[model samples]
Target: MSRVCELTGKGPITGNNVSHANNRTRRRFLPNLNDVTLMSETLGRTVKLRISAAALRTVDHRGGLDGFMAKARESELSARALKIKKEIEKSLTAA
Candidate 1:
């Protein structure tokens, strides 16, 4: 999968670069992505994902890294989760 936050659905953003000379240029604002191995309690396997720091924060804020991991491991993706994942992918690609 692409670099994204699976939990919070955070991704890269597009923007402009401003120069001291008053010139505007295109730039990509990338998210802070990290690779983490999530153990799937249901599947009984470890799955890898590239996600953003903010996304991780969401998981942490919700419970903690272990809680989120356990959720992913045991719980199947709900409609909301799939929708959010799709949005994150779209934003990352667009940026």
Candidate 2:
């Protein structure tokens, strides 16, 4: 699996590690990705995703998967997440 956050599309960033002796080396700063199962109130199902810790906090703050997906940008979502978002929208509209 990739090291990208499924929710926020956070990926590894390139930087440099500077030594005290004035030496620098290339390094990667990766997002804190975790495998989590978040529940969708509208769909009444849990979806699994690899997301950053910050994204997880945002999800909780936004009031769960449904709320987050409702406000999430389509470009930032992975294919799986986009499908889930569509399903949630369809369910909410059909109700």
Where does candidate 1 stray beyond 4 Å?
39-46, 65-95
Query: Model 2, 1-95: lDDT tens per residue?
Result: 89999989999999999999979999999999999999888988889899999999999999999999999999999999999999999999999
- List candidate 2 segments past 4 Å from native: none
Model 1: weakest 10-residue lDDT segment is 69-78
lDDT by residue (1-95, candidate 1, tens digit) is 55456555566788999999989999988778887765533334455566677666666565744446444522334444554444444554676
Question: How far does residue 57 in candidate 2 sit from its true spot (Å)?
Answer: 0.3
All-Cα superposition RMSD per candidate:
10.8, 0.5
lDDT of each: 0.57, 0.94
TM-score against native, each model: 0.54, 0.98
lDDT of 2 at 27: 99
